[model samples]
Target: MENSLLVETISCTDGSLVGIATLNRPQALNSLDLEMTRILDKALKDWSQQPEVVAVIFRGAGEKAFCAGGDLHSLYDTMIEYKGQPASANEHANRFFAEEYELDYLIHTYPKPIICWGDGIVMGGGMGLMAGCSHRVVTETSRLAMPEINIGLFPDVGGSWLLSRSPGHTGLFLALTGALIGASDAIYCGFADHALARDQWEPLLQALQSTPWARTAEDFQKVTDLIHALPSIELQTGPLESHRALIDRICQEYDLERIGVSIAALSQNEDKWLSRAGQTYMNGCPGTARLSWELLRRARHMSLADIFRLEFGVAVECAAAGNFQEGIRAVLIDKDRQPKWEPATLEETAGDWMAPYFALSIDDPSHPLATLGR
Candidate 1:
């Protein structure tokens, strides 16, 4: 109920059997800032301990988006604040990524049945929160992606853990191109659990809330049946679907150079969307793309805790590097839509450039989340 937090209410419907948490920042598309993350973390913990709260529902306030992303303006500002001092930037970066990762971990390991109503633009940090929920419900409006490459950062906030588990090379395709998936395609890629029409949300919530607390499983079944009754929203079709086969084939290459070559080949294709996505990748941060490839590849066998820890290290490295600030300047601050990346080609970003991300420093301790159980 705190006014500062993005979440609005913690109301119980169905006689306190279900708690509903609504993300209230409609104007900003319900972006999750640090304060909002702390608020959500606390709320989840609070409701999880309440015996009366049989289930919890997470949804955004407006129709535009479930959650767009984290408040990167704050992140950019923090980076700028420590522009002159490496120690200051590292200190701030560690705290930021650690808190964010901890919140993601909490969602992954929450005891209660946490249902997320992912209705619209769920990207980056939003995807992090949704991926960990017990039940992820997507609408036709849902447009999901891990677009950190666009911002000169590899997808963090547990992206390394979830994306690695996606089907075949689908995760790589998403990571490299920053492609957005609709509801059915999201379900196809294992990013979302249920695909329901937007209108069915209120009715579904009512049904979930009305279920008896003692017969939680039975009540959940009733709600599922109601959801099943809703009309099906068609999967992503046309050029997006046609391009998938080519994307899966081309992006399957482990080497970043081959991946770039494959993406460049798409430029000659007749498919406009693929061509645009190809161009986007061509123009995006080569260093970030390499980091993305490495992160997802390394994360394939890592535990969630380890993946988060590894990404924390990478994020700290990004803050130290100049790409994050330059990317933000071009894409967000300047709106010029052109980033002048250092060592602009994939060939320039060799193994040496990325070695520091994997190197452990004696000065820093292991992540506070090292204690996270599998």
Candidate 2:
């Protein structure tokens, strides 16, 4: 699938090279399938070893999205085939998640600067990839979220860690509501570093190519300076900022049950944004809400590697359950927008109900992501 991931090397002014990886499945919003994931991981690995490659830029091919999410269609198929089995029993999910997490971790710990052009829709796995990049650029069109709750999945791909770090309890609010936020909100949440007009992408690329490159700390600083030199775009205030007070107050509760009631009550508010977020939470998978909250809490203190390991198990366990499959079926296959979560309600998923998701599903002594951050 050469078309899936178009890898290129652009010669810089000083004879150094800038590696570019473009996610090419624009029709599908560049969603990562297993093959695309493998291609990207290999490309990144190869670039890391090439000293002449001073930096890497990741972007999707289309104007509509950088990447909407992962290849849910494929994951849905895998889940259907291995229904009722533990995460260890679902080999494809395990490998897909394992490789994806490894790829994300690599971006986080990459030896060189990585610029992620986060234009258009960036959510779920897309959020993961962008969050790892050192230079995260958002355009006027950038719309971001960790909306796994909608699909019966918690925010994987380092989302737990990413969300946990959001200002105040806005992270908890996002995890529970699957809210759609703009570039400003994304930047406010620390999901993006720079905000540029969409057209600046080309100019930014040209600037990068023209700069004298050095594969060192200077390169990272230069990349940052170049991006900062680009013309800025002023976006309208996003809901996250406007509703910060309310969001923080609602999520401040230590008990998720109390938080759920507060969030669900927003549906009746006169403000459409708050009401919509509230409705989304009300309609989302109870299991996902539970997992997202629990994971975000745990990720607050764990090392990045540990978060990935913990998410791997939760992802696999999600595959074993019916909610993930049903969420996919309704949202993607059936297009019905209805998912019947097994636990049925937040009240039902309380306490140790999430214990199984935290447990390692595989028998291997060496965890799949054990090599991360080593």
lDDT winner among the candidates?
A: 2
* Residues 246-314 of candidate 1: C-alpha lDDT, one tens digit per residue: 767887776779988888777676867677678778888998888989988889887887888788778
* Model 1 alpha-carbon miss at residue 203, Å: 0.3
Cα lDDT computed for each candidate against the true fold:
0.77, 0.89
Cα misplacement distance, residue 121 of candidate 1 (Å): 0.7
Candidate number of the best TM-score: 2
Q: For candidate 1, what is the lDDT?
A: 0.77
Clashing pairs in 1: none
- Model 2 clash tally? 0
Once superposed on the true structure, which residue ranges of model 1 sit more than 4 Å away at CA? 1-14, 87-90, 215-226, 236-241, 361-365
Clashing pairs in model 2, backbone N/Cα/C closer than 3 A: none
Alpha-carbon lDDT of model 2: 0.89
Compose the digit string of candidate 2's lDDT tens values, residues 182-245. 9999999899999999989889989988998767889899999999888899877888998999
Candidate 2's TM-score reads: 0.97
Candidate 1 to truth, TM: 0.91
